[model samples]
Target: MATASLSAFTRGIGRYALVAALAAVFATFAALAPGFLSGANLVSVLVNNFALLAIVAVAMTFAVSAGGIDLSVGTAIDFASFAFVSLVLAGQPIPLAALGGLAGGALVGLFNAVLIAGIGISPFLATLGTLFVGRSVQQLLTNGGNPVYLPPAGVPEAFRFLGHGSVAGLPVPLLVAALVIAGAWLVLSRTRFGRVVLATGIQASVVRYSGIRLSRVTAATYVLVSAIAAIVGLILTSTVTVYIPSSGNAFLLNAIGATFIGTTFDPHGRPNVPGTVLGVLLLGIVANGLLLSGLNFYWQQVGTGLLIFSVLAIGFANRKAAARA
Candidate 1:
């Protein structure tokens, strides 16, 4: 058992590419500016992008690992925030309000599951439809295309504490993100479901023939992904003074960028959660770094896109070479 576990762990490590990319980026940034690594600047990037990138990237890892995609993730995050905040402002209890918020996102995932797993609809089409559905509902709830301001009452101290509070000298967001990474690693490496899910990713037909229940797995994966995304929304709502109905729309591209980051980090055929965390932080640093250095947000976008493309190209080339061997 020990030998087998060690082998699998090593294999998992081998599949990742994000760590190398991270090292390269760090070197480049240090060469570009000594102030880039300033304590305040690094901490700022972590606090800003840690929650968004960690949740969405991890969720997307599951989706891509299963050969499915959840394009509605951005909408899911926005709608969740909109729902939760609206409920709180309406005098609902905090826990119930959070649940209500999560429902908006989870229901979308269930819809995707039904269409893709039950009715045999394409994953792309199914999620695309929910993307609009969730976004439209958010708009309708906010009265036809306006971002709503959320009230501060009835939001539990714990929820607010999670975003602003610190633990053992670490910010709550960073602490939570670390826990998430460890949890994902345990689930992906130490559980039967993880093995099955990844196996299904490699070949669903093989798993089915091996007596795995495809439908149940498919539905469950979507729900889990949706829930993970929902957590991200809750974090955003907690941190921001006001919740925006469409705040997550900007993250759509970022999420895809994160997916490529995940793929890059694991170019050897493994997905690297820690590397993903690094990828998200690096992306954050680029924006925050440039802005601090007097660059505008518009140029930040172009630079971010180029950096992501570079990561993807290098990873793809490495993967192709490995395949040929």
Candidate 2:
């Protein structure tokens, strides 16, 4: 078999290999910790990750599906959260401040789109630049300090409801995550824009040659990603009631790792919403399980990084095998 053919087969199989690896990891953790899958802990994991991981996973799906990546998403969300909470604490109405913050995210997306698609810069490099810019902006705004606390006065219980309240005994975060997943799935599965993204990701020039405007699709994707990130920021700050400039740091690595697993089952090389959601759940479970197992917080980070690397390696192997066949 030719080298290129063999590589492609490997990539194809690497996808499923990731699935098995994810399952195996869960099994090992369960065996090592008796209460790893208890009803309470299970719910805990879902509730914690539902906002951050699930939101970014769904957005990463859109970004990656469009044949692009946004390294800045994590920090960008932080900026949005800080800007938003600061406004609320300063007595600004929630709607006005939130809309402005969400718009700010869209602007960040627009910046990324311009750099990557319009200027023909590499998406990785472009987003890396924005990642720093976004983080720096948050730091600059906060001036090397934590943001002021946002008291819940005048904030609608229903608005905070998305983060804290539950429906049918299930946390609102889960419901929101589900809704985001369903929305993403619908866009990818049922829309012309979705088809455009797939085409662009595989070969933008080819689609462009067919007279389609690929840049628009690509640019729009960054906007969508940033918007989603802001939405997550909103829920997160509400849940915590304070804005930490570095709050979204964990999402940077966790999101990429989970995002990859999501793509295996989806059309756009994205974290299939369900796969990404499950991946988020798995990450939450891993951390919670380790903590419950008496592992140090430091060990949790180490184990998580290693787990992500291992899963990526398995995904690589699967993709390679499938390519060769």
Candidate 3:
């Protein structure tokens, strides 16, 4: 009984470790980094640094929770950006252009689904192949990676609102991120589909034996992830008013890392929406604080790596101790 009690206590600590780490990081920055807590800087951290990443990380959470990973998430992002910019430049209305972009992203998801589910390819290799093919296709489409720029004057106000405008004095991107997070939370916590997803990750054989169409579930999971990624593509293109080939790849590694970091918060080490959001916030704080502290870009990355490693290491240690107890 004592061992069981000790195990429960350790598990509790593991679950809340990320929260504690976030507070420590914030307090450290607020004290050591000038402007870290200033209103403008705080807003910038949420909107400019964290919003898009949080979205992408949430998208990643879906794939990770489903016992798979989407290496071609950036492929969806780049394709969506390419389509949105091209459609807008062709003078289509913003709504139509946005739909086109979403459709383009869905194509990547479809291809991945067919490869991984229908054709029985491993998720990692299939998406990795998709990533390579996607990069090449974009390069070919852009005549060697040249950026497609939108006419600044011609960008519609509605589209710009997604990236820059505010609602109730809160940035639009922040609101959008919140909506995605909330929706993801609801689906994962309250729906049959969500239960299947979690079960699929934990025990695929059991799920298959239960007569669920694993293939359809797998396909839908990839589609959902890509669809979410497409939203970020649109927001990013709208913000920059340009489509740069492969620019979406920038968030790929970070999203993966953030998602994994979030798993540490789950007692079973499962990926979850709330944990992923907290992980993204932690990363955003570290990034902004490091920049303010005058760390070079490379060193900033080193710091981020060290932070992730430390968090995971500690979490794993606690998890093991709990098991032993």
Candidate 4:
């Protein structure tokens, strides 16, 4: 009886620990970092720092929750950026350019789906191979990975609006991130497809036995994940007006880290949209605050790593104690 009660208590801690950590981190920065809570600085964090990572992390949540990891998510982002910039520079309409970008990302997902679902390759190996091939393609296209920049005079106003313009005093990127989060939450928690995704992750054989097409689910999962990633590519290209090959790799580790950090919030250790958002916010705060505090880039990484480790370690210790009780 005591063991069961302890186990329940530990589970509760595991679920809420990430939330507590986020609050505590926010408070610490607000107190110690000058102007940390200023409205403009906060907005910068949300739009400039948090937006891209949030989108990619949300993309990763679907993949992870479906029992797969997409190392090629950055590949999607890079290809989309390349396509968007190429078309925009070629004088294509903004809408068409955006579609081209999305299509580029979808192509990466299709390739992965083909390998993983059609040919029965492991997700890790399949996506990793995709990442390598993507790098080679980008290098070949740009004279060894040279960036493609859109002429400032040639960029359309509508294209700029997606990255820099405001609607109702909110950054466009933030609004987009919010919409993605909401959509992801709805799909994960409120739809039949969501249940299938969750069940597929937990037990693929059971999902198959229930008459669900596991291959289709896996394919859809990767496609949607890559499509969402491509949107980030478009936003990034708009913001910078340039497409830097392999630049999306910057968000790769953090997306994976944020997604896993989020899993700590689920008592069952499942990946979730809300938890992933919170995790992204926490990392964003840490990054912004550390920069304000004049920490070197390497030290900022160390700080982030320590915070992630500490949070997971504490939760793990609690669970271990409960098990022993």
Candidate 5:
């Protein structure tokens, strides 16, 4: 009886480990960093550090929840940024350039979809190929990878607004991130198609037996993932006013880590929007706090890596204990 009770206790701790870790980290930062809890710093963490990663991580969640990983998410982001900047430089209107950006991202998705859904290639292999091809293309386009910067005088106020402007007292990027989170949550948790997607992820053979067109669903999912990732590309380009070749890859590792960290929120270990958001927040706080605590960039990454390892280790241990019990 005592052993059984201990197993239950262990499972409970494992289930809420991520949340507990987040709270502990927040308190640690608040105590250690002088301005860690300052309103301005909090706002900066949310808008600057958290928003873009949250978006990309959420995009990753879709692919993961569907039983796949998108190694090309960064590729999609780069394509969108490339297309957006190229069009803007060609004197295209902002909206047109934005559309072209989305199209660019969608094209990457479509390529992956064909390779995976049509040709029966595994998602991992398909996306890895996309990433390599995308990188080579970017290098060729930029003449061995130079950044394309918008002329300061030619930069549009509207473009800047997407990155830095506020709407109703909230940063625009934050607002966009919020919408993406909410929309993804609703789609994954509420809609019929979302249910089907989740179900498909669990067991494609079973879903296929139920007369669902697995290939169609998989194709749509890759496209959705890329489109969602493109939003980050737009915001990134706006914020930096430059398109740096392969720069979007910077978010890839963190996004993957954040999405997995978020799975700790679910009893069944499913990837979820809320979990992803919290994961992003935890990393964001850790990053900002470490910087303020005088840690260099490399050390900050080590800190983030350690934090992720700890949380996931706890969660996995608990899962094992629960199984033994």
Candidate 6:
């Protein structure tokens, strides 16, 4: 009885390990780093660091919950950024450019859908191929990978608003992130289609036997994932006023890490919206705190990596203990 009780205690601790680490990190940074808890800095962390990644990580959660990984999310981001900047530079209206951006991302998703759902290719290989092809296409379009910059005089106010403007006293990007997170949570946790998607992920054969069109669901999922990722591209381009080739790939690894780390939040190890958002917050805080603490880029990465490992390890150890008990 004592052993069983001890195991239960250990498992409980492991389940909340990520949350504990996040609080500990935040408090530590607040104590050690000057101005770390300042309102402006907190806002900066949310707006600049957390918001974009949160969107991408949530998008990633959909793919993960659907029993696949989208290595091409960055590809979607780059395509959207390219389209948005290209249209703006060509004297198009901001609305039109935004549509073009979304269309570009949708195209990438459509391609992945065709490959995975239509051709029966594995999601991993299909997206990996898409990523490679995307890189090559960007290079070719940019004449060996030069950036497309929007002229300062031609920059539109509405476009700038997306990245820098505020609505209801909140940054626009953060507002958008909140909306995405909320919408995703609702779809996944409350909707019939969401339940079907999760069922497909867990047991594709069972879902298929239930008369659901697995291919259609899968195609729609990949498209949705890419469309969500494109939001990040729009915000990123607006922030920088330029579309740098392959720049969106920078978020790919971190987004993946965040999504997986989020799974630890679920007893069954499922991907979830709240968990992913928290994961993104944890990462965002760590990055900002490390920078404020005078850590260089390399060291910041190391710290982030170590933090992820520690959290995942704790979760894994607890899960094993629970199984044994």
**Per-residue alpha-carbon lDDT of candidate 4 for residues 1-325, written as tens digits (9 for 90 to 100):** 1123555545658656777888888898888889999999999899877989999999999999999899999999999999999998888999999999999998999999999889989889999999999999999999999999888987889999889988998889999999999899899888999889889889899999999999999999999989999999999999999999999888888999898888777666678887788889989999999887777889998999999898778667655665676
- Steric clashes per prediction: 9, 22, 0, 0, 0, 0
Q: What is the lDDT of every predicted structure here?
A: 0.72, 0.73, 0.89, 0.88, 0.89, 0.90
Which has the higher TM-score value, candidate number 2 or candidate number 4? 4
Model 1 residue 8 CA deviation (Å) reads: 12
lDDT of each residue in 150-233, candidate 5, tens digit only: 998899887788788899999999999999999998999889878888897888899899998999999999999999999999
lDDT of candidate 2 over 1-325, digit per residue (tens): 1122544434454545555766876788788877877988777767774456888877887777777788888766776777777677676777777776677667778899899879989889999998878777777777765575766676666457656888899887777777888888788767999888867877888989989887888888888888887777777877877788767766767777677765553322344556676666667767777777888889888987787677667665655555555
* Location of the lowest summed lDDT over 10 successive residues in candidate 6: 1-10
In terms of TM-score, how similar is model 2 to the real structure? 0.86
Q: Candidate 6: RMSD over Cα atoms?
A: 3.7
Better of 1 and 3 by lDDT: 3
Model 3: lowest-lDDT 10 consecutive positions: 1-10
Clashing residue pairs in candidate 5 are none
> What's the true lDDT of residue 117 in model 4?
86
lDDT tens readout by residue for model 1, 120-191 = 777778888888887787778778878666556645676576568788888887777777767776676578
Error of 5 at 267 (Å): 0.3
Model 1 vs truth, CA RMSD = 3.5
Quote each prediction's TM-score: 0.87, 0.86, 0.95, 0.94, 0.95, 0.95
By lDDT, who's the top model here?
6
lDDT of 4 at 230: 95
RMSD of 4: 3.4
